[model samples]
Target: MLYPTLRPIRGATLLLTAGLLAACALPRVGPNKSEIFAGSVLREGDAFVLTVDDRVNAIAAVAPALGFSAGFLNAGELGADTIRAGDTLGLTIFENVDDGLLVPTGANATAIEEVQVDAQGFIFVPYAGRVRAEGNSPEALRRVITERLAEQTPDPQVAINRLAGDGATVSVQGAVTAQGVYPIERPTRSLIPMLAAAGGVAVEPDIARVTIQRGDQRAEVFYDDLFASAANDIALRDGDAIVVKSDSRTFTALGATGAQDRITFESRTISAIEALAQVGGLSSTAADPTGVFVFRNEPEEIAEQLVGQDVTGPQRVVYVLDLTRPNGMFMARDFAIRDGDTVYVTEAPFVQFNKTIAALTGSLSAANGVQDATGL
Candidate 1:
């Protein structure tokens, strides 16, 4: 514990010297540049000069391309979910009372039967055989069945109810509480509701990355976007496969920052400015206001455009944002921190020089019996 009584008394000259000494304290050490931004992305003219704009644009465009934009809920409401083959149907044939071929005595004038739609999209009945059942609703199937039986029996009534319809189903797997196939019975049902039906995420998936794979292509969105934007809460179509997995996006904060740690994002997206805030911002004493760099691996397309070559894969790009400028603030705000990014703040160039002077001053003050003004 520090107390006034045990503190060092410093003369004006010594006080100034000690103040300068503290200002020149060593800046925080961070990850090596070669290790963080590894690869040919930084090789001479072959290297593409990447910037924050490139990253933001790539992500902004890619996210929406993967179905992360707005107006999805409205569009989903338009599609009607209909029956398909492999769905089980509860079929009942009814006729006027009195004993008959279709309605036997004490059979209650209703013949209840369970039938499954075949691969050829057909269902068999006692009299109406080989009826097409796929692509038609249960009610529609009942009408079709009724028309087929009308000629066989007078006043033949038919009722069809879905027993086990697994046709309109979405495959929900990976890190979800209930991983299985969930049937989509209503057109109004969207992504969130479908997740709820599958028993919500198993252990809170990374909200920024929930993937949806349809056919050969895949799309992803931030978890919050499903609820925050209607377009992101896209309606599920038949055979839409969803995956809620752990967060893969993370950035490391090093060098002259308030805290040096690998920070993982909880939200779908975070800007470079927001990322700095998460690590408690830059150190006022050690950090150079003009030296803020974001280290990242850019997409190949971006690399090829700037490099003017056929860059096949991810390229290393170091984006430097000068906080000393007024525009830098806006730039940082617009600059997005991507997955596996590293935010580094370099030390001021004069810090080492200042430290050498302060060390000499503090020594002279101590030899002359001048106590430290800061009481250290």
Candidate 2:
């Protein structure tokens, strides 16, 4: 009978040990066992003429007007000018009178507003007939109208009137509240108002990623400085597009890390170590100090391209960094991560097993308690 009792006791001890061992074998699920390098190894600045298909399509969905204009002009032209066709023209005219003598029938008229300019660049005046208005200054247009009307009446009372027709329009696209054409009347229009018309910039407009496309060229501008400084708020020309784009760059931290994750870099640079710190550091118990590994896309290929060389080898390569040493801290700073970098942390074998064992034991204990309460 004593031997039988001893056997049951030993059996219980073995089961407990097995459970703990199984738990130890479980995988680590947090950041302590994993690491993420915080920057893109991919370089975005390189000038590549390759056709951007689906990406361009997605961008167009957010700002359809951009796609329309981009089709008309190359990426480069879109960067500089803001003017586009179908915008209203405003004109001011001063009719010539005998020196300073006012005509008996003369009446002062304000400059015309909303003068419609056809696609052919002709402005229709009520009495003056169709006048070529494209590429002419307001004063020049005033003179042209004055001369034409002079033929009809002596010192024809002509005051260049306000623009009544659409002169040119610029489309505000992407991340704006209302994405549509904005009519330009003056040489200068504030970006805020234009954005307001299209619905102000989309929530959290990638402040650093504003793009202006004119003709074939594309210009990347920072919205913060551009809007803050009056000097930089460049006057918009016809056919210009103000695009508030989405943030393409992002860093994800997942696992047993303290904070778990963070987005956006306050500074231009973020390192693997810095990324870890941003998320509340690593968990000590389940963390495997020696097993820390950072998986990242290979940076050498991009770096090679930046220096101007063709890679004849396979393009598949992933970088692994060991963070066990003090020197590894410097790698985070030296190795620049690009947008879309993912950081992962793994758990230590012992800690993982312990967690699993604890979970199992807790589950069993709860089941036993329930059965006892039910008298089963």
Candidate 3:
């Protein structure tokens, strides 16, 4: 019966065939245009290519393209560099002869102890009584302690050292092997040591951004860049917070390419050439070398930057790269692929034509069979 004939077309293969037929009915994207693209898109020259020099210039600005630099953006005047309340201190008050006051002036007198600075930031001492240890360097505390002892004892000496575990702490959070508020126990010049202590970033350091929040100031920089540039690796301050955010910036690759997927930039920046290599290069047989384009929704001001263009909205900003030409390779070297870019490679015209013929022939054969069965 008619119902039995239709029943044979209700399985997985039939469903797949139906899906393909539906797809074939819609207009496929060509080399020049895309369904998602809009407005009057300028070609390679009209749109900016973004050379290495351009990136260098952009990096020097107040805010860079990929992210912001913490040290460069810090505008607060230099604050007092000292310990805060709740910090700890290790004190050593030495007496060469080991004889003094409570020790009976010769009963072997020596004390080495660690004390927590009270909420008020005061630490108790034998002769100095409760003295302020907060907001003072170890050296500064030593001078104050020595001065306090001079009045009561002869040849008095004092040395103060800030304890790391309970004092001088920095908060490390986000994508890290270990995340917690860790103390700057040892001398920490940059974020590397602190990151190491916390078991480093959860992902590859190259694929993360380290955001440092000091006081009210907040800025972010790529973790790899932070280590590469000495200036970027500024010392961590007390109460400073650091987060290792996964690289959020990404670009898409589609069409006749070795791989088609959303690709996140591993480093601070990457050029179009590098991006192509990352995606396993274009599909050698089916890809049209002349149809490689990078799509972006550019800012309104970009229209002015390009000459002879009727640009409108943020819908269209396409950069075409012709790999077939000799100089095209050179131009590609300077073309920087920004975050959220769509790198598309159109299928070869011959391949598209072959696909169209195949789809049409299959559709005709199915229609004839249906007509024959219906006796029309």
lDDT of 3: 0.68
Residue ranges of candidate 1 with Cα displaced over 4 Å: 1-65, 68-88, 95-101, 105-112, 118-121, 162-167, 171-182, 195-208, 215-217, 224-233, 245-247, 266-268, 304-314, 350-376
lDDT of 3 by residue, 123-198 (tens): 8887778888876767777888888888887767776776653556788999999999876655453577888889
Please give the lDDT score at residue 371 for candidate 1: 39
TM-score per model over all chains: 0.64, 0.54, 0.64
| Per-residue accuracy of model 1 over 1-376 as CA lDDT, tens digit each | 6576544433445666666666765433643334334433455433333444545445423422345434333444423446788888877777775665478777746656668888888988878878887777677778888887887777788877777866667899987778988777673367888888877777555453588876765677656557665567777766778998877768999888899999888666688789999999988887876778876666887656545678688776667677768677887887777777888987666665675666766566564553344335
Q: Write the per-residue lDDT of candidate 2 for residues 1-376, one digit (tens) a residue.
A: 5455443443364476566766564445643422222222244322222111233222211211111233322222112222223546665544455332223335443356677656786777655789886756556677788787666555654444333433456788877767888766542354545666676666564333567776776666555545555544454556778888765556777665675664665444466677777777667765554444444333444524433456543233233444566755555434544455665566667775677668777766765575567554
Q: Candidate 3, which ten residues in sequence have the lowest lDDT sum?
A: 55-64
Better of 1 and 2 by TM-score: 1
Indicate the residue-level lDDT of 16 in model 3. 58
The clash numbers for all candidates, in the given order, read 7, 76, 0
Which lDDT values do the candidates have, in the order given? 0.69, 0.53, 0.68
